[model samples]
Target: MTAGNRCRRNVLALTVPIVAVVVVVFGFALDRWVIDSGIEIAPEPAALFPSAPIMDPARQSDLDGAHFDALFAQGIAGLRAGKPGQAAAAFEAARRLGPKVPALYVNLGFARLALGQVDAAVESFETSINLRPAQANAYFGLAEAREQQGDMEAALGAMRTFVHLASEDDRFRRRALSAIWEWEAALGRRPSNGTDAAQTETNEYAQAKGSDLLTAELGRLDGGSGTLAHFRGKTLVLNVWATWCAPCRVELPSLQRLSEKLNPEQYAVVGLSTDEDPDFVREFLREVGVAYPNYLDPGRDVAFGILKIESYPQTLLIRPDGSIAQRIVGARAWDEPEMVANIESVR
Candidate 1:
């Protein structure tokens, strides 16, 4: 071919390919854009965060106080709905968005406490109180945690603060007073009689008097071959629980670890699950990574009465002869050195 013809042919070849490629790319882009436009974008993960500070349906559109108020209210609603884990997640997100709001931390603490993250709840409440000294709910939450840990004095102190700060909230005020009086009377009676003291310790009060657990023979689940009588002549850690109780869930793993570490010759750990639904209890155990042998309480309240358990997550340290050595209730950081010492002391 001549030079001009050759040049023209080469330009056509390059231009034609370039134009085809651009048209193809544009068509693909258009198709993607159309599809994306029809699809709704998913909500932000943290968009569900509580915003109670500035909450007013009429005013939520504004970035002002009403928006955050709505978030906070949403979190509170979550709590009322029995969705504590969701409430906590909401409160935590709200806290990040509005760092100065002490109420968010207090709410977060409540949610965490309900979820059995006791230490985290304590920390959140402490932070709330530090930020706003007048936040009475935080103090109440701290008191709850202290009570769970069996620290009557500290629990009382926290309750007193709650009463002092939230006198305006009549409900809280009445509750705090009742708790204080009950704890005081219980404390007075704890040290006087060993048996009564042991009973007191069955709930959270057992942390105070340092009492022992009484070994009571009880019926077995599924009509098992063994009986409470079989556990005789052995030191035992008997923990009462229910799948529905969050604190019970947290205490389960700790009890398991305690059991695995101790020699049966020296000590035994027994789990009594108070779930009326055996299947639910078994499923919960499997889901929660618990390996401890669990006995079902046919008449849940019967076991409670026999164990003198005043609360969920009640743990008893029993002597070889089936007498109580110590009783504790609620979720405690069992791995703590002090708790370890307490458990070891009974042996």
Candidate 2:
């Protein structure tokens, strides 16, 4: 072939490949935008309770929308008035009118709990969770029911899962985490490993789905000073721990080491204790020696409000932007390379 012909053929080959690539990219983008569908499962509820039995929700024809709305509103009013039985009846009537709606199941669960129908509440919450596992509130309800039945382990597990599923809101997350920690301590099975494998899974899911962490704020412990805003512009590593927690005892040293290693220009670590007794916290700190600033949260004021911290030794890696970067539900090897890498990624 002539040299000019050879050059033209080469240009054509490159152009064809580029065109094919563009077409493929465009197709994928279009599919992504068009194929997005309505979510079937509502995000897990912030509350969870154990499974139980109660009267079935009533079934009504689809045409009864107005009736359903009225019943649902009345049910909510009943719930607000601390009449779970009345609320359940209202929600059941609404459900009978609109059998497909899952929020009514959640409402029913709340009403059942108020009536002390532990098993029934669990069933309602589970139905809600199954219908919408992403709903943190359902999970929270299920956990609450389990707690009522004295099923500490399951309740604790569900509570942890709640926070893991919803840690973006400082309020709910703090409350959930504190509840989890409190229960775990109460059961004497606090996990201190701070395992990254499980945490990585949760973080990936939250990031991909844009789920919020629990962000409710508990009241201040003993009127402790400083809001979470005080830690703004700095990476805050907050650990919710208790003196009696085995895992807390195991993880304290590593946390101290990590705090010491952090450059104050970027990071800070604080340990909030739920020891119930400030003296226990003070004595433990004095004996074992925590280098980071430690505060007492015996009543879980901070744990309940800002982070919804559910369990002891729960570590939160808060970014300078004041958002949670990583949340380790149990104790962790703070000095591990992977932990440092993950924390740094958010930084």
Candidate 3:
């Protein structure tokens, strides 16, 4: 398949990024959004990154945003203090625990930018923009990243786009304008076609494309193997989660109930766990009394590698054509009336 034809997860919450000085003052980082530092980051794999012992999602997710807030706040503090490593770790943890928040990526991008991780910052900001277009912060960060890369044309495009899209009350509008003026002159010095490339990429949000699932391999709960193609012609509510995730566990019951409410002929609510311990996932599901059909992506070969998913408790609504209808990051009360209507709307 061609590059345009692939869509594993767009799972890329495809999340977004960042705090930046709109004036493009390369050395002097200023603004309320620029983070301060202090938290120490661990060098372990993302799944094993260390944190204070979690209080259990039972006491967490149901409350909606406490654990996430604390962690995100920690990341902000770390960034404010200029500790990008610490901030990156905290934000990475937040993406796992919190909703796949776009701004979180922006903050992450800001830290990366400060750390001079220009390429990574671009990816972070682009991911944020993918998750949410028309976001001033992500565009601002993108412009900053482009400028740092010496792509003056791209930088001007992003900044001008930012100026155009920013809301009237946006705090960064003044700074964006200042950056645009500076970049335009810089672009005048040497003309380049970088803007079109940047805009082309910007137009394609991760969610804007359809995903192909016919080739996706999955392991069934009962020692069976299958492909997502098996469920063609029905709307698939595919939930990507992990047993280690508090929010995933907290959201399971509702998902199970939602599955019960769905029509077999028209809809299917499926669980895809990214747990390495399949036995543990099976036992956990059984203990939780969840009856929805579940599958595994042991070692996250499919979840992280193919899908490029970064957050847990993310759900994607796949149309009969296998195109993703909606991608919701974070946990939600799946059986709520509003939720039922939302799912039904996809019908």
113: Cα error in model 1, Å = 0.8
Give lDDT: candidate 3, residue 64: 44
Give the C-alpha miss distance for residue 79 in model 2, angstroms: 1.1
Which residue runs does candidate 3 get wrong by more than 4 Å? Answer: 1-211
| Model 1: per-residue Cα lDDT over 147-178, one tens digit each | 88789888888987766544232467667766
Q: Tens-digit lDDT track for model 2 on 1-347?
A: 99999999999989988999999999898877777766657787765544766555795474475788899999999999988778989998887787656677888998999898989999998897776554567778888999999998888778767766564553566666667767866776556775433345556745743432223332244444444555667888888888668998998988888877767777788777765445556667878878677766443535654566777779888777767777789889887777666766667
**Candidate 2: residue 287 lDDT (0-100):** 84
lDDT of 2 at 323: 75
The candidate that wins on TM-score is 3
Ranking by TM-score: 3, 2, 1
Q: How many residue pairs clash in each candidate?
A: 30, 91, 18
Q: Is candidate 2 or candidate 3 better by lDDT?
A: 3
Misplaced by over 4 Å in model 2 are: 1-60, 191-347
